[model samples]
Target chain A: MEPVDNRAVVDLLGALAYAELTAFDRLAEDARLAPTLAGRAALARMAAAEIAHHSRLTDRIADLGIDPATAMAPFVSALDAFHNSTRPSTWLEGLVKAYVGDGLAADFYREIAAFLPPADRALVEEVLDDTGHSDFAVREVRAAVSANRKLVGRLSLWARRLVGEAMSESQAVIAEHDRLAELIVAGTGDLGGVAQLIDRITSAHTDRMKTLGLNP
Target chain B: MEPVDNRAVVDLLGALAYAELTAFDRLAEDARLAPTLAGRAALARMAAAEIAHHSRLTDRIADLGIDPATAMAPFVSALDAFHNSTRPSTWLEGLVKAYVGDGLAADFYREIAAFLPPADRALVEEVLDDTGHSDFAVREVRAAVSANRKLVGRLSLWARRLVGEAMSESQAVIAEHDRLAELIVAGTGDLGGVAQLIDRITSAHTDRMKTLGLNP
Candidate 1:
């Protein structure tokens, strides 16, 4: 793989770190929409895990001697736009957004982990795995839709909206960060390789949908 | 101790649980005002721990077959009012408020734990101690004020506002929940004992203020 410049890496890491911080804040607020105490706590734990990810990424940014906020400044609008546009309005909607939305982020980080230098690679790797709270979301989402059966149609629709908004923001980031895109593309060699990456993300998302008994 | 009604225990647990949930939300929001990423993450983790406490308290509430929200409802307005009225306008105010305010809750919970049934007592005992995060806040507050010297005067004044607002809301809660008050007075033995509980809370606040380089 071709060597990426430190500036590009810093920008990437800062954007990722800010994303984690905003995710933590957004998901923590979403926890309020939970129908049950168990559900609220489950989402809260997920929010908390984002802070851990935020910490690791922020530490790396600081070690590089860049102002973390300055590094993060460029992406703030896009991230905030993503969350504001896709804010969930119901308990079921919140769970689906968290499960489906964060699942996508976990996938993206795993893919990008391979492109990073060793120290940065390890940070990405550390963030790829899920906290146990996904099961809490799964349990609740499954119960809600499965009990009514017809509610699957509604939730599946909600899942699609989450994906759409996430993809929209991701495209905005890609357009904004050409250097970062070059790194991902350089690692894979071509559009087909990018297609394969998308395929994997799509498949994992499908598996999640099936787990919740929603039509993929 | 006379047998306390299970319903009363559920009410207390639910109130504490929701309080933790909202505290998590508020603190996560407040963390953004921190001057450094490390500082922000520290506050976020402290917020996260409150969510964990919420989880434990909520589980106990569910075990009692109560709808957690219903059990939490009676105290929601009063608690919300307290936070809304005492919203921290700056990073220092936020930190000092978190330190003094949560210190009060932890202290009160310690006193109220005595009035609870065994299981509930254990829950309160577990939730009361946040030694690491409290220590982190104490150190940060002290360092900030010590470095500037002038800031100490400002924060001490902020602490006074926090206590005054808190006391007003707390009195409302006490007046609203006769059973809870009965349980507290029963456990403590008299109005004098209640006064002593307040004294202990105040003494702890003084120690914390001293640690933060503020006047008691």
Candidate 2:
């Protein structure tokens, strides 16, 4: 096996850590859109789970002898821009975003994880674990969509927008961080390899959207 | 001791449950004001802790055969009003509000806990545990104040406004909920007992402010 690139690993961890932090922020913010106290609490619990994962990723980054914040700083703008541009306007939109958006990001990260050493791979996978949010989002969105079929169309469009914004942000992040881009290219083995990776991610996202009864 | 007042117990739990939920919301929102990612993560972690406590309180309320949402519904308006009235405009104000505001609330709740049965009191105390936010807020606020002497006046005023808003909201809540008021009166033994409760909470608030190097 080839030796791991420490800089690439740091970039991956940093990106993941900041992603979790923002996930926590956005999820918590979206909880306000919940129509019921129970719904709000469910989203808040999911948000809390993100912070726990964030702490784990940051701890691993520190174990690598890098300051977690310093490592995370470079990716902040791109991540913030993605979230800002895709802010959900309604409760179902928020749920769909949490499910579809996070599902896409998790799938992408999991693919990247295969390139890391075993320990780092395990860390990435663990942090990306669904934290029961998938079930909650699925149940909520499915129930809502079933009650009002009109929601399917709006939410499908919302999901597409989420993916589009995420793709642009991901591209920006990769373009700005050379080592991170190298890690991706190295893992995929070529530009074609990267295309195949996106294919896999897109396929997974379609399955997720179908599970939520939304159009891919 | 007198038989536990089930309605009062439920009301108290409901109030605390909603309070924690809003605390989670406000703290998570305030995190965006943090000057650094490390500072942001610290606030986000504290916000997560509030959700954990909220879960526990809601669980106990459920164990008593009450729907958590129904129990929490009564206090939502009061709690929301308090938070809306005192939204912090800056990072230091947010820290002071978290420290002084939460410190006062905890002090009051602890006093009320003494009036409950052992098991219920234990639950209240457990959910009200500091969650490490106290030290973080104190350290940050004190450092900020020391570095800029002019901040003392602004933060002190902010702390005072927090207490004032909290007091008025508490009055509204107690007046609105008859059983909760009975719990306080019965526990304190009379109207003077209620006065003393406020006195104790106020004194502790003053001490917390002093600890943060702000005026009471």
Candidate 3:
């Protein structure tokens, strides 16, 4: 195992905390797009779960003596930009964003979790609890695609765009934060290793899309 | 004591359940209007707590052999209408609404809970937990009102609008459901009794508004 960089660990956790907070915000907003009260409540529950995860991450950051806001500040723009770019215009789009977009980001962070020191790794892993988000998302998205075949195409495109924006933001973070990038390479070993990590995230994301009957 | 109307209890619970669900939705929407991430996250947490309460109420409704959706369905429109009518046009309004508006509803339900049969009463009391929503709201709204004295007029108007819309909907619910209304009158014993109850609610609300330096 490569030597750990404490600064990078803090950076990673900060990014994850802000991601969960923003995800909570986005999902809560998207819950409004739900077609029925039951559907809306279900989405809201998922949104709540994100906040639960966020509190854990934020508390963990505080426990580490980092001013959570300072650590979280740099990544807020990148995360907020991704959401702004992929604003869902419909209930179905919101569903896809909550399910697919969140899963992709989760996968990306889970990869980095492996590189984390044990205490921090545990915090990362714990905060990533899905609380049935993927199951609900998959079930709902698949049902929609089954009901309207054309949605598979449009939603597939939306899923692709979400990933495009997310990846660009991910690249921006990597470019700006050398320590975090180094942690990734250290976890995977080198440049090819880093490429493999991307491949892994893409593969998982594609699998999730396919499960929802959307194109990879 | 008035004989418990099982159907009315279910109706009351259903309405409460849906009210909590929509409150969750409205708060989540209002969270986006927050001026800072911390404030946004704070509102989101409150929103999540509403959904948490909604779940408990829905579960208790099922325990009474009512379909949770069927229970929640009737109140959806009234609650949704109230939210639509009182949509906060600014962040301060959102803060004020969460405080005064929800406190009003909670107080009203606290009145109803007193009339409920034991199991239902416990459920209602438990779900209505403020979890310090009023405190968070009061502190935030007071700070804003203090910083901008002119905000007092706009916010006081918003608070009154919120309560007005809420009261009309409250009347509609009572009118539409005789059993529930009967329970209320039965619990308090007649017109003056109901009047006194309203007075109590108004008093609490007035104290809250004064604390925030807004007109009741």
Candidate 4:
């Protein structure tokens, strides 16, 4: 593994920051899909955390002497496309998306955080890890699953689709961000090594599915 | 001013909390109407702060052994009616709603906060106040008004309608919750005193309008 530079780390942080911002917006929109007021408020609270994370990352990007919007631009389309292609059609679907989809994304982010420089890495770690967020999602998904065992099949399928879309976007981000790819290479070596990193993401995702009592 | 009891303070705090939660949800939804990413994000950030306020109030309600949902229920219809009656039609109108409408609402909450028990009053004073939020709304409105002088007239009309609806709802909440009304009465005394309070609120609002370069 080679050593990563400041620019790649900054770009990576920028992408994560904008991702959080956009997620907050999208999840807030999706909260309307919730079946109950409690559900709606829960999702809105989660969305709020995303924006808070975005604010922290934005501050870091500014400290790096980079315009936040400029640094965030490259991943906008990939992130938007990920969301657009996977709009949930129902309350259950929305919950599933928030639970299953975000878990996988966070796992990938957790892996990438290790590749960042110490200060940048801490920011990535801080922003990407949302324990309050994940617990809520997991609990919501579990309650729904327990309430109606029949929901498992459809939810599992939805979860799979969300995972697939996320994987596609993750690959697209990698392809475009040669600098980021370079950073990963510095930390973990060759392209094949990077591919293994995704396999690990997939394994963690399966663990999440099992945690939700879904088939791995 | 009359002293406030725990139940009355709880009612007021719960109402404010739910108002913040609902505002966060609606503003996040309305953010989609923004033509630019920056505009959407600004609204999203504002919405996030509302949730942070909501969480604090929710915790306090729980501490008082009240169901947050039950405490929130009475104000929901009035809040919904107010927002529904004053929906913005343009991006500038949205900014005006955020600036003028939220400014008025925050002012009202601050006034009411003074009528509560000491702990609740301090919580209300501390938790709901965010200078960052008001500054963003002010900046957005100022930019819009400065960019197009004609926007002032339409937004002024919108502001009047928003205030009217808010007034109607405020009266409804007062009528429905006698204990809460009594707390306000106790804090400021009878009809004449309350009228003076209203006058103060109105004067402050007028000053806010002038600051926005809108006609009072």
Expressed as tens digits, the lDDT of each residue in B106-171 for candidate 2 is 898899888988899999999888877679999999999999999999999888888889989999
Error of 2 at A29 (Å): 0.9
The top-ranked prediction according to DockQ is: 2
Task: Decide which is better by lDDT, 1 or 4.
Answer: 1
Models 1 onward score TM values of 0.81, 0.97, 0.95, 0.93
Residue-level error in angstroms, candidate 2, position A114? 1.0
DockQ of each: 0.49, 0.88, 0.76, 0.69
Docking tier of model 3: it is medium
TM-score of chain A of 4: 0.93
> lDDT by residue for model 4 over B1-216, one digit each (tens)?
445578887888888988887889778877878876667778888898888888889889989999888889888889988888877777767777877787788878888788776788899888767647667667778788889899789788888988888898999889999987887777776788788888888998898888777887
Model 3 misplacement above 4 A = none
lDDT of each: 0.83, 0.92, 0.86, 0.82
Model 4 spans > 4 angstroms off: B1-5
RMSD of each: 3.9, 1.3, 1.7, 2.0
Kindly report the interface RMSD of candidate 3, rounded to 1 decimal: 1.1
Give interface RMSD (Å), model 4.
Answer: 1.3
Q: Candidate 3: what lDDT?
A: 0.86
